[model samples]
Target: MRLILRNDLRKLMFALLLLAASFGHAGATPPPKEDQIILALIQRVEARTDLVFVRNGSDHNATEAAKHLRSKYKYFKVELIDAEDFIERCGSRSELTRKPYQVRTAGGAVRDAGDFLREELRALRAN
Candidate 1:
């Protein structure tokens, strides 16, 4: 009877191990590569305090721009297949007014936000 009980205990342990392994695989998966790139681009925006983000007709600081981009990313995540798609869809222009987004450097130079982010993305990929 003791030997039979030991065998049962081993079987139970094996079953538990299998259950744990299955759960590990079923747990939350990491974001896709493009999503990671998009997130990195947003981080870059947040880090660059020397730049001003212009959307529509208003200027925003880096933090505000990053926040807005995050909101847009969540809204357009399903449609984005790559970092470029994210730049074009969420970072490039105002959906409401069709106005292109702009970025102003500390030196007072202005450029399209999409182009800026594309350059950043290229740098990230190179690294």
Candidate 2:
């Protein structure tokens, strides 16, 4: 009878531990809501461009910039907290090329990626 009681107590303790762990997990914060949206915006920017971007003071096409951003996402050094952070750290410049990115729009207007994305981010926030 004592052995059975001990076993039951052990099982009860295990169940309590599991319950506590589950509660802890439930209380943890979820990932930011803007990660996927920012990625899609990058793709949109890539698709909309028809001219060259100045990367490290040289011209690069939209495809190249998009590819570079994708690669950065693959091996991110830290967690991306939001869309703005992702744009500032990943999409606005090229770490590998050590340069700020500038896009030349289809109409031949050159704009810095940071400025362009800030406007885009504002639009997104509004909607």
Candidate 3:
């Protein structure tokens, strides 16, 4: 290999820096949520919930996913509200903020999804 002169090395380094900067944000997007085939995903989640026992899903965050599961189970209720809406009502600093569907049920009855479902669904349905 031939030695690069000081000036040549400087230029090469600058060129490399430019190239690196140009590709800096190539993979920076937040990532697309599979909106197109959301229906398919909902169906699959529903099937999974049915095959197994207990509650499975969220409330405000995963409305679409939850609704699909509910439809499949006929007893589960999936209510999706805007994260901002939850924050606005409950306050932004709340841990549940931005979660939208954090899977909250009544009286800590999450383990008992089928039992007291009416009470839990009503609570989850709350804004």
Among these predictions, the greatest lDDT belongs to 1
Task: Please list the residue runs of candidate 3 whose C-alpha ends up more than 4 Å from where it truly belongs after superposition.
Answer: 1-4, 28-62, 65-127
Q: Write the per-residue lDDT of candidate 3 for residues 1-127, one digit (tens) a residue.
A: 3456877988999999999989753433212332222333343334433232222343433444345343432321122232222222222122233332233334433333222232333344452
* Per-residue lDDT of model 1, residues 1-127, tens digit only: 9999999999999999998977752433225876888899899999999999999889999999999999998887776667887888899999999999999999899999999999999998998
- What Cα-based lDDT does every candidate model obtain? 0.89, 0.72, 0.36
lDDT of 2 by residue, 60-97 (tens): 77787777777776555254656776777776887777
Instruction: Superpose all Cα atoms of candidate 3 onto the true structure and report the RMSD in Å to 1 decimal.
Output: 13.8
Evaluate residue 4 in candidate 3 and report its C-alpha lDDT on the 0 to 100 scale: 60
In candidate 1, which residue pairs get closer than 3 Å at backbone N, Cα or C atoms, i.e. clash? none
Global lDDT for candidate 1? 0.89
RMSD of each: 10.1, 8.3, 13.8
Off by over 4 Å in 2: 1-32
Q: List the residue pairs that clash in candidate 3.
A: 59-101, 60-100, 61-100, 61-101
For all candidates, the clash counts are: 0, 0, 4
Which sections of candidate 1 miss by over 4 Å? 1-31
Q: C-alpha displacement of 101 in model 3, angstroms?
A: 17
Q: Whose TM-score is higher: candidate 2's or candidate 3's? A: 2
